[model samples]
Target: MKKWCDNAALLTLHGNTVGMVSKEFVVSAPGKIILHGEHAVVYGKLAVAAALSLRTTLHIKTIHDKDDVLLHLPDIGVEVGWSVPEIAAAVALPVCDPEKPAPPSEELLQKLKTFASIPHDSADTKTLALVSFLYLYCAIVGSQKTLTPLEIRIESKLPVSAGLGSSAAYSVCLAASLLLHKNLISASGKWSEKDLQLINAWAFQAEKVIHGKPSGIDNSVSTYGHAVSFTKGSEPVILSQVPSIRILLVNTKVPRSTKTLVESVKKKYDKSTVVMSAVMDTMEAVAKECLILFEKMYKGKADEYYKQLEELIYINQQQLDIIGVSHIALEKVIQITKANGLCSKLTGAGGGGCAFALIRPDVPKETLDCVIQQLSLEGFDCWETGIGAEGVTLHV
Candidate 1:
């Protein structure tokens, strides 16, 4: 992954051309991991997250007309055109005119209303991803902001709704692109660590428009461009490098919806405090243990650290299984990986998306290849990728 840039500029047109087409900023966001906390994180439990190599990239080019805001996602072959008049008409609410400014706190609500009025489905994963970004861009610029016709095209290797945080990656990439286009970053130079944090926070806010209450782990890791320990209320804390920990991401492609899974979990939790409290308490302990393992590894106690981390991952996976997020394919992948001498578990929101395996440093490349082929034969989409990727960054 490349570093962020600030010297982005517009491509000059011929003398006769009136509009300046900016150099397209290709922004990319990475997939994520739920190292410790999964369901418990929703209730504000701590969780460790890492950026994955699988990423979503968005390409943005400014166009000329107010009615020509076009969005295209080539990977899924989705394209949409938005007219300015249509946006204005859709946003004119009964309580306030489209032409007038609303109060500060209500600003976000009004923008949300505009988002709801736009013809997009919360159920359509890719469309929700697109509209969330567009809504943020339009609202951040406000009514006085002039948008030259713009065309945005997204292409990704990340699978949709597959627990890889694909949609969050799309949202973060889109947010970074629009921010770069609007000159929201510091003018002095490349994006600083603080700038990346700001980007992640803003991206998390954008995702709330879609997910209703996202954990913020996905966007935070994606924006920071590296592995982090994310807690919803606190800032993401970066982790130091640990070479022995290698991650494998496997897709079950079961096509589960996160909302449905979350609702199911919520219902179960609401019905039984003893059961739910015990489960969440277990997850919280695992997160704390994982953190201790990381600290030990960083402080040169490698042997004990690996053992504790592996235990944490194994126990966490089982908890997710008991909570009803693990699918048969996920279990199969975990079994195969473990049989091949790797520590493996489920990643992301569970239900039926992706599983993760922590490979031993001594494991040969052939073993990894064999595991991938074995999974593929069983009709699983297997991918081996590294952790510790850079978060969201813009390419000029």
Candidate 2:
């Protein structure tokens, strides 16, 4: 791989020094869009997800004699650091210091300690996701001499908090970078199924820091970098070997909290068995349809495959609407897209995140443009993305 030199050594942004670099690794994780299973995935139903082109990259470099780790989050203007030993100790320590206000548990403290070791006084724009990665790095690789107070730089192509699983991509990239730094995965070799599983496991564990209770789809897709049939609390089932198909990711700047959405689902689930069962059934059907569509398309029947997929997409959106997760922006996009007979649906945890529109090959450019214009008029942020592009990769 070619090295990308930013020429930062000659131009220090804030008096931060660059040391003799031992090695640097670059890793990427794919962004994701959910077709259905917003609240249903938690109950053991399948969700159809595709990997988006947007990704997050982590640049990890080792430095000499620098007890201080530096994090240069240029995208978020965060530069901070802490001593290596101190951070490890912090993670090992319990939160309750007895003298302090309820010390953190030994496990939780250990994770926080590793996070504080990040090279920055304040967390960056992607701090939560980075912290999750740090915890995983310390756990799997151990805080040995091989890992030291280092500088990490992050760049993300995905929009943060836009329902594109940006945090998942960040965590997955961080885990991949740390593992590569430890030489767990060969730089030039292909990763085996076991290697992918290990990476996914580590990434999922790390995701806890960003999301209190992640369903694993975000990390799984980001780690595997392909469309898969993901069921909560179950192993991911790879949908195809050919990778995901192309789609449009329309982001609604309106932010939605995953915790809130999850809680909402839980509340409704406990209140109405009928509603919950219906939502889960819809999700299961959507998942099956997506799988069938993939199979049909793989067999060289593109038109029929798209037709089925579009119908499924519409049905999935209707389910989301029934579940009260769909936002006005997402619904508007769906209406506009469907008005032109296009396939579109909410992609992630609804309630104002992002949506996806499956485009037919024969659809006229004018129709697509009209759909986009209508969405734009409704204040939706939309863009085209290739599916199943690439999973996590290291850059040196």
**True lDDT of residue 84, candidate 2:** 67
Which ranges of candidate 2 are over 4 A from the true structure?
1-4, 7-22, 65-67, 85-127, 140-146, 262-272
State model 2's lDDT. 0.67
**What lDDT does the true structure give each of the candidates?**
0.68, 0.67
Per-residue lDDT of 380 in model 2: 78
lDDT by residue (215-308, candidate 1, tens digit) is 6767877777556775668866777563335677788777776678878888888898689878888988898777776666756856556666
**Model 2 per-residue lDDT tens digits across residues 1-396:** 122356644212121233222355456778887766666787888877778887787766666666656666555656666566776655543222211122124457345744555443433436665566456645544534333656677778787777777877877776666655555655542677766666777677666666656778788888777677877667777654533566777887888887788788788888998877987897798887777767767677567677777777778777777777888777777778879977787776788888888777787889888878888888877787778667775443
Model 1, 183: alpha-carbon shift in Å? 1.5
Best by TM-score: 2
**Residue-level error in angstroms, candidate 1, position 117:** 8.8
